[model samples]
Target: MAGRSFLLRVANVNPANVLTHTDRALYRSIGIFILLYGGYAIVGAASFVDASSNYTHPWWQWLVGPPVAAAVIAYDRAVVGRVAVNYEHLESADPHRLLRRRTAGLYTGRMVLALLFAIVITEPLMLARYKGEIDAYLGTVHNRELARLEQSGAIAAFQRQIDGLRAQDAADDAAVADLHRLAESKRSAATSAYNQALEDSRAAGVSRRAGCPPGGFCDALVQQSRSLNAEATRLDQEASTVRQAQEPARQSRATQFAALNEQIEAQRTSNRTTVESAAGFGARTAAMWELVQRDFWGFGFFYLGVAALLVCLDCAAVWLKLVSHGNGYERAEARDARRRELSELRRHQQELRVTEAATDVADAGLDTVVREQRLLDAAVSQATTRLLAELEEQTRTALTPTR
Candidate 1:
């Protein structure tokens, strides 16, 4: 009666103690589960957040969302009170240490998971950058092509200028030829008139010497010859001056045409060079574009693989957790089996040590027995030789008795 009354009193005093302990255990288990679930959720959420935005959103913002929620929950729930109660009996033991270890492991796993997600995400991003670079290169190539076309047109125009200059030079040459012909004709006329004048003078002198009286007709003829000679000389001088002046103009026009022709040729060469350079640039740009496309396609496949791997990892984790929850007995049995294997290995090692010692003893005894047998073989040989000699002597003695 007294034992029953004591038990009732103790149970009455702490009716809620058992429930409290159970609640604390349940909460801790829930906390561990929550921690793992939260980590996975955070990882997945962060991936979504990172992928949702283009290159603009901040990564830190995505990272902070989950932790912020957890922090708020912790603050509102007074996690400190619960922590104190749960750890009251583990003051020296530090039960939270296990939680801390788990939390650390969770953090490490999350980091790895996040890194994997980032790797998968960054592939697409790098492909996008590659595409942009190739596009920009192609744009530059196109611009150069356009500029080259314009340059080619300008070169054609320069060629036309050269052609016009050549035509003008041809006209100048023709004018020069006409002037030369006119000058030559004028000089011929002048020479003829001078000769005529000389002839007239000479004839007049002959007439005077022959005693022929000089007539007014001869004087008039002389005057006419002098006037004609002077006029011819003036015309010849004017033609010669015009020819000299035309020579410089024609040479200048030819020089201008030659210079224009050189410029046109240079322009043609430059245009050709530009065209070739642009072609090279275009080829390089096209190759780069093709490379970018290839890389993008590769990245596309890589991203798909990563996504599938992530899904597989997630499914495996979920299945593992489910098995942990649903098949606790099997897991426990497996752990027990592992422990039994360890024990069995230790027992085998001990048995092997004992067997090795026994084998060493047996080998030592065999060595000693072999040495004793070698000594006994020598003694047995001596005894057998003596016995054979005695038997021979006995046979001789017996033979003599019979005689």
Candidate 2:
């Protein structure tokens, strides 16, 4: 009730406490700005901090910070030390409970608006930064892993295949060379035999004209010439066949070489793509990481600030209630003094009891005995109790319902 009373005063302090048409419109506008910006900032900071840190997020650090600040401020404003001079002019009238409710609602709206603005401003930027960093890191890692795997075995196998094809190409070239050489030798031998046969035929014609008919030697020479010519032609054809057979092998070799080139090109392209991808990912990751860090700090500060504000407000409410109800802050101060005195009194009483065990209760009452036993130590405490008793009696009389 005391806290609520303080908040009501704050609400009344606002020039536009009542919502007229124009005031209502202005209130809406304020709400929009505060909620939007506050939510944004808060969310941004929260997300950033969450992403950036490895530690568990602080769940309630903000809770105590604000209230403690507000309480100290309230205590200062209340001025608790001089109670006698500031006791007059206190009002006893209370506003309806409905007024308290309305005040609470309005205050809540403001706090929520502040929170919303925080989220709106902070969350998106932090998130973008975080995502970029993560993506880049992953891309670089993937590329490195793939490269390692290829180096381990895949690349070597590809090179081995190319080497085998090259060896086969060489064998094909040698076979083509042997076929050309055999063809040339056969042609040269055929020409030589033909020339010899022609000479023999001329000599035989002369001999026939001069004496007996041509004999077996001439026929044998002609037959041998024909056989040599036929043998040369067959050899030439066989060599041509060998050369023709080499064509498919040569073509196959060319195809194999082209395929190897294609494979190399493909690998190069793939590596280029992967590298580019990795670069992009790295950039994004760095950006996101930075964003996350920024957001984290922002949220931490914002939450802390808001919480501090709320706590101060709560303290103000209690102080305001005391002032408004005519009790004055001195009552609380006096009450605290009383509690301290009571504690001290209890300690002295305990000591007295111990001392009495050796003596007897008939000596004096507990208070008098303690007062005598520790006069200096109990003086302030005795005065505080007297003042506190008077303050309590006054507060009770004021709060009592009228007949």
lDDT of 2 by residue, 201-262 (tens): 56644234322234644454456666766666676677678768877977887787788778
Could you tell me the TM-score of candidate 1?
0.28
lDDT of 1 by residue, 192-251 (tens): 654554555566443343222356434544566566566656656765676677677667
- Return the TM-score for each candidate structure: 0.28, 0.28
Candidate 1 at 137: error in angstroms? Answer: 7.6
Alpha-carbon deviation at 133 in model 2, angstroms:
16
